[model samples]
Target: MAENRSILVVGLGRFGSAVATTLDSMGQDVLAVDKDPLLVNRWSSSIPTVQADMTDVLAIEQLNAADFDTAVVAIGDSVEASVITAGNLLDAGISDIWAKSVSKEHARILQRIGARHIVNAETDAGNRIGHLVSGNYLDYIELEGEYNVVKIHTPTYLIGYTIGDAKVLERYGITVVGIKSPGHEFEYGSSNLVMHRNDELIIMGKQDQIDRFIKG
Candidate 1:
């Protein structure tokens, strides 16, 4: 099982609430804070929640923000509030801080305020939906720049071939990192292993290469 994380989430807007509840359900210790008492009260029974203004440095310090493994400033609408909250988290020595960005300007502000990650939910959701509708990937995760890790059903062309015979690297410029078989756990993709129609492949490569491999 994966190790649980302790997370501090500031802001109780839609995105913040979603993040907090998801983390809590994943068995992480989550503490949620928001300026709105109604929002706090609504979530208090589900997770540890407090009605506190995140823009205030003293309030953040009182929360012991640095004690958590990660902190998220999910204040989406106000750039000022987001920056101030992110700054307070930094001041509190919370190293891993994620801030929501409504626009490029907001993202730059969060970056300047020392937020480690800036998430643009709309863009991310659009990308995910595009991939899902493409009919190629079962799931996809963007790695750095143009690279991606993708899960796909084994291609018909490789159904009866051994991994070595498939020439995945040479033909597709992608690597098969692992294979998930029906009713079995994932196994490393060994060169000598034979491919099966029902297997799912976890591949890693540049986006273009993955596209080509899928098209073939």
Candidate 2:
């Protein structure tokens, strides 16, 4: 099992509420905070909540924000409030801060202020959808640099061949990590494993290599 985290979540809007509730469900010790008493009250039964303006340094100090090393600033509407809240978290010595960014400018400000992670939901969703629309990948995960992991339908040319016979890694510069056939669980990839027409392969490689393999 994964170790539980203690996270402080500021703001109670849609994004903030989602993060708080998800973390709470995952058995994390989550303390949700917002300036609005109504928002605090609404979530109190589900998770611990505090009604305090996070933009105020004194309020953050009162909360003893340092007790939780990780925090998320879910305030995406107002750039000023978001920046101030994140700044306050930094001032309180919270080590890892994740913030929501409304724009490139907002993201730049958060980065400049030492926020460890910034998420722009819309931008990310758009990019993911763009990849899926190509009809090649069943799913895709982008990793650091140019690396990617993708799930794709087994190519027709390889239907009757094994991994070794196809020389997949030698020719394509990508590894077939796992394969899932119709009506069956995923199995680890091996040199002798036969490629079936209906199998879905989980491949890992650099972007250019993946693109070439997919196009071929």
Candidate 3:
């Protein structure tokens, strides 16, 4: 049960409210606390709403941060308040803290002050959706600067071929990281298995090489 883990969203703005609503709608137990009762009212029973000044460390502490494993700080506009509230959440003994940042400098400050994760909210969502729509690539997550992960339908040319016969890595720059076959056991040895039609393949390689291979 995702909603049973307990989530605390401190700010009830657009971003925070969305997160809380989504989590609550999915059957998770969510506690949304905000300084503005009006903001709490606007959530409309989507989540367990409460009114409290998140900036006040004492008020935040009263929420029993130790009981919740993760807390999200979505304070917008007031960087200082957001950071302070994040710091309080950390000091109060929560394990994971995710904050929304407005800029690089603010993100760095939050990192230095101990936010475990920071999201760009607006840009990240757009970029992720854009990547999913761009060909079969879902955008690379690696930091080495030369590799990417992609999802592609197994090519008909390679179907019914053994790994030894296909030599995908030798012929193409990409390598198969995972292959999925429906209604079959997952323990099949690599040496004994051959690719089948409509199988899903997870491949990794350079962007240019992957593009060439896809088009080839």
Candidate 4:
């Protein structure tokens, strides 16, 4: 189980609501705030929520934002509202603040206003989808720049080959970090370990190298 932490989420749009509900489900102390009374009332039974305008500095101060370990400004539609809300959270001494941004300009503004993190939700979602639909891997997570950690089904050509014989590192520049055989838990992959058809490989490398490995 994870340790519970107090979180303040401003705005109750789809993104904000998802974050609040997920955190609440994980047994975290979540305070969800929105200007809409209807939205606040709807989530109040499941998660602690209050009807308050996030842009109002006094309302933010009243919430005692400093008490929460983290704050999320999930107001993507309105640049002014998002900026003001993020500024207020910073002023209240919330050191870890994440803000949703609709554009590059919005992201820059949020960073300039002391938001510790800025999420471009649309771009991230698009990139994730692009990776998922590429048809080579089961899942992909972008690391730094062009690197990625990918989960892939063992290719047929390597079905009976050992990791070293497959030359994954030499030929593809990818490291097989772990492998999961059918009906078994993942184990650290060794160079001499033979792969099965139903096995899944957890590998990490540059995206181009991963693509080349998958293509072969």
RMSD of each: 11.7, 12.7, 11.9, 12.2
Candidate 1: count of backbone clashes, pairs at least 3 residues apart or interchain = 0
What TM-score does model 4 achieve against the real structure? Answer: 0.60
lDDT for each of the candidates?
0.79, 0.81, 0.71, 0.80
* Stretches of candidate 2 exceeding 4 Å from the true structure: 123-216
**Cα shift from native, residue 27, model 4 (Å):** 0.9
Backbone clashes in each candidate structure, one number apiece?
A: 0, 0, 2, 0
- lDDT at position 107, candidate 4: 92
Worst 10 residues of 4 by lDDT: 126-135
For model 1, what is the alpha-carbon lDDT of residue 33? Answer: 94
Instruction: List TM-score per model, in order.
Output: 0.61, 0.60, 0.59, 0.60
lDDT of 2 by residue, 1-216 (tens): 123567888888777787777666545678989998998999999988999999988898899898985888888679999999999899888868888899999999999999987878565443342244234678778787888898988887788788889899999999999999999988898999898987999999987788677666
Tens digit per residue, CA lDDT, model 1, 1-216: 123567788888777887777566545677989999999999999988998997887887788777887887888778888888898888888888877899998899888878887888676543442353234568778776778898998887788787789899998889999999899988998898777887889999987788678667
> Clashing residue pairs, candidate 1?
none
lDDT for model 3 = 0.71
What's the lDDT for candidate 4?
A: 0.80
What is residue 160's positional error in candidate 1, in angstroms? 24
Task: Point to the candidate with the largest TM-score.
Answer: 1
lDDT of 1 at 123: 61
